[model samples]
Target: MITPIYRVQCDGPGKEWLSLPEGHVTGADVTADNLIAAPTAKRACNWPGEKEAKRAAVGAGWRHAPDSDFKTWFCPACQSAGTRP
Candidate 1:
């Protein structure tokens, strides 16, 4: 099993607690956008992940946003289009 990442913090004199842990996603948990469109398109896209996403992001005219680890791995197009990752 994967170890969860988290940190503890003191809110006030009342008590202290831990913050919500942001879970990590393995490659298996990731899905390609092409796969999402496959059912409708009736074909497999076989689109790559990080590399392709970064490329698409650059192509979309962004300097450096897709590379941010602060958020999930959203598609470059989605990020450019202002959608949630």
Candidate 2:
């Protein structure tokens, strides 16, 4: 079976500055690892093709940080205010 490998673009802060929301709860002991482990799916794209996915994400005002992992993406509002997750 050819399981399609769709690229998941997370609508959250880039890994470099990734962190949980101010009041987010994980039901576990708060730790550095977990604090930055959560990712929000507020806006996501599951396009099978990398180029197409990136095109769609960018079209929606998502910016890909060059220094971050490919999966990390910031929403339009965040990008405008230069905010981080």
- Global Cα RMSD, each model: 15.1, 10.8
Task: List the candidates' TM-scores in order.
Answer: 0.22, 0.45
The number of the candidate with the highest lDDT is 2
Residue 40, model 1: lDDT of: 25
Candidate 2's C-alpha runs over 4 A off are 5-8, 11-44, 69-71
Backbone clashes in model 2, listed as residue pairs: none
> Residue 33 of candidate 1: its Cα lDDT?
22
lDDT of 1 by residue, 1-85 (tens): 7543332212123222221113423344333221221112222222345555444333333333345552233333344455532
**Model 1 quality (TM-score):** 0.22
In candidate 2, what are the lDDT values of residues 1-85, reduced to their tens digit? 7756344444544432233345555454433333232244432223567776566556555677776765667755566667644
lDDT of each: 0.31, 0.49
Kindly report which residue pairs in candidate 1 clash with one another.
none
RMSD of 1: 15.1
- Candidate 1: misplaced stretches above 4 Å? 1-47, 65-85
